[model samples]
Target: MTLTLTVSDDVRALAPGFTHVAIEAHGLVNGPSNEAGSALLDDAARRLAARLDGRAPHEDPHEDPHMAAWRQVYTAFGSKPSRTRNSAEALAKRALSDAGLPRINLLVDLYNAVSVAHLIPVGGEDIDRIDGGMRLIRATGREDFVTVSGGEETVEHPDAGEVVWCDDAGVTCRRWNWRQGPRTRLTEKTTSGVFLLESLAPMPVAEVTAAAAELAGLLADFSPGADIAVRAPESSA
Candidate 1:
């Protein structure tokens, strides 16, 4: 059972520097990097570039007004950037201090390690094998997004145009490339992971790319590997 990851062209267009950097780094290692589990992430800098491909992103979240706008939406929608306060994320952070070695369901470990490894936000779902749906598009100004734990929900659309990734069901994830769906989420029993990689303001382009790649690499490293890829925005023109 090989693992597979995929990304949208929108994301690919963002981080030319990081992608180039990763490719070079892989080449420098003078070895093989299996494609199955490798992941990719991109945001502000990469998206606004002219070439639309490289190792370094063009903009940082803090400096990108578009990103800042999304942050506001993330907050309005009841989701927080990975930098926000959350007991679950905090606990996961503490656990990583001694994450030791990766030896769980290949997909699970792949992204979980990503969570701890880059300290950026990476999310996935059991789409290929799970019994639910996911969505990441913007609300129709009348969407009814029911969260994992029943509670009030709010959302803000991005100025660069909201990049939504949804399943056959509802809006699982929101924003162009932030947050994730709680429904299509992964579990200990997960064997195949379909994920969405993300990075937010204050985090470096290098870090996000590395985190994304780590997941992709881990998937490739597994006996039963995974699918790794990147996704970007649809352009604001």
Candidate 2:
């Protein structure tokens, strides 16, 4: 079945420049992280470093135009950008840090590589686990967001007016991509998945499409014979 994604009108008004591309694939070959995956992450870090162009290693990630756009969106939604950064900024900081990015599984590593190298937000979910069509919308603060705390399952609610990605099940991601719920996250055994590449103003739709293409290529390489489909970047505005 084809997975559907939509950005609500309210979310478009909140961030008029919001654009996204979706990649859905089946028959994937996922496994433990390996040498190739580590190499990809290393190369992505180098690319990000080059983009920084001598900026102080300790400098805030929001200095980048794309990240700055995300910060503004976060503020518009009543979230403190500093305390709750989008996934791309968080990954970029870790990539530039001495500790470097963590090696998750092959699929995670591949998507993270694309995200850091392109400096855009990219996320993957196990397609089989999604309940129905996913929608990006402002939360009512009463929707359930199932998560893990201290190794136990827990449920939390998003703040009213906060942007979230949800489906028939519940909130899959909170605070406009700040955190992904554990329910639909990709895992080592995942054979089918959907990846979303998101961007805001100052980052052209062309760049977003390019990032999605790069990710699709990487997925085809790592998961040979997988049926991959790349949707054109669509603006919420």
Candidate 3:
């Protein structure tokens, strides 16, 4: 089956400059981080630390035009910018601060590293767990959102008109680049997955394409035999 990732017409009208690069890779051997994976994470952490100097992401997430554009989309959907930060902003803040970044698994750590380094929202989901194709669209306030809260799995629903990533099952991510649902989250057991590199205007398509390429290359090196395909808004696999 062919997996597709797309933004809806309404989403386009809301943020015409918004674009994303989707990458699908199979044959991943999800496990502990390898030498190459650790190197990539270390490199990204160092780069992010240098950029931080002493500033916090919360100081002015809106300062980054790309992040500001995402905030606009969140606000348009009734979410508060202060409360809901995009994934990249949140990760950068943590990586730069004393808290440091969390070393999840091989795949999550790699993407998180890239996200902080590039200052863009990147999300990875297990494609095998997805019910159908993925999409970015405004919610109707009734889509089921399966999430884990306080260590227990529960079902929640997205607010009406909230921007979300969804599949045939329901909402996969809420508040645009905010939290992801537990149903399709990437874990150590994930062998086939999709990665999303989301960006906005002022962030050139070439840069985003490069980020996607870097991610694919890293995966190729860490997970030998993985079949990776990348697709941007203007380019196909």
Candidate 4:
């Protein structure tokens, strides 16, 4: 692995437009960092959810409870927010200042905070047993874009050119805004979690690393009681 990263051999098969990211870390929770982050998300969640009320639907084919609010906003915008940078930022501004849910936890809220504030989809899965090495590529209908779990809700046309984060398991995650990853998700009974700050474009390795540090720092400052580890994609020899 290069620079502490352990990349899978599937990199060679990735589509030309996709960039891969992977991170692994461990840390202690309940400190100042965890507390502040939790609060920030709490506050943001309340405001965001309120704004998304009546607008965010429970079933958008790309259903995610944590992202129901933001997804509602995306649906309002027709689900095509230009795929450019700052899309998250626009959504966050609308969500926090406008109005909806006052009942989400801090972890989920903070994820929304970063996602909307930065215009990137941030999502995670339960810390379950993930089967194999993951790869990021395009879904040539071979791997269609399924939004909600149980293969129920899926997008009819997922911007065909858009890159998707998939594993051998399936269309397990994505980058447009709300991400889904087997290892990086945080859920109930979760004491440890990992966060990935994916790039809008092929960011320099330095910048990507820097974003990871800042995100971890933000968590430490806000959610002062949760353990968070931030890292970069695994490097190869």
Off by over 4 Å in 3: 34-36, 50-62, 234-237
TM-score of each: 0.44, 0.98, 0.91, 0.51
Candidate 3 per-residue lDDT over residues 37-139, each given as its tens digit: 6677778867875665646534543566777777776787798987888898788767666667777788998898888888889999999999879988988
Q: In candidate 2, which residue pairs get closer than 3 Å at backbone N, Cα or C atoms, i.e. clash?
A: none
Q: What is the lDDT of candidate 1?
A: 0.41
lDDT string, candidate 4, 134-219, tens digits: 44444454654445556565543344444455555555554344345333345544544445454423334464465456556655
Q: Give lDDT for model 3.
A: 0.82
Q: Count the backbone clashes (under 3 Å) in each candidate.
A: 48, 0, 0, 42
Looking at model 3, residue 49 earns an lDDT score of: 58
Q: Write the per-residue lDDT of candidate 1 for residues 1-237, one digit (tens) a residue.
A: 323233345434332211211110111111222233233212211222322223242222222332353355456545564564222133233432343233334354455555543444456566454334443344454443335444645443333334455544545555544445455555544444555555443445555566566655655555332334443321212
Q: Rank the candidates by TM-score, best first.
A: 2, 3, 4, 1
Name the regions of candidate 4 deviating beyond 4 angstroms. Answer: 1-39, 42-79, 82-90, 100-103, 116-121, 127-129, 144-161, 178-185, 201-208, 218-229, 233-237
Cα misplacement distance, residue 97 of candidate 4 (Å): 3.9
Instruction: Evaluate candidate 3 by giving its C-alpha RMSD to the native, one decimal.
Output: 2.7
lDDT of candidate 2 over 1-237, digit per residue (tens): 889999999999999999999999999999999999999999999899888885656566778999999999999999999999999999999888887999999999999999999999999999998999999999999999999999999999999999999999999999988999999999988999999999999898998899899999999999889999998878966
Report lDDT per candidate.
0.41, 0.93, 0.82, 0.43
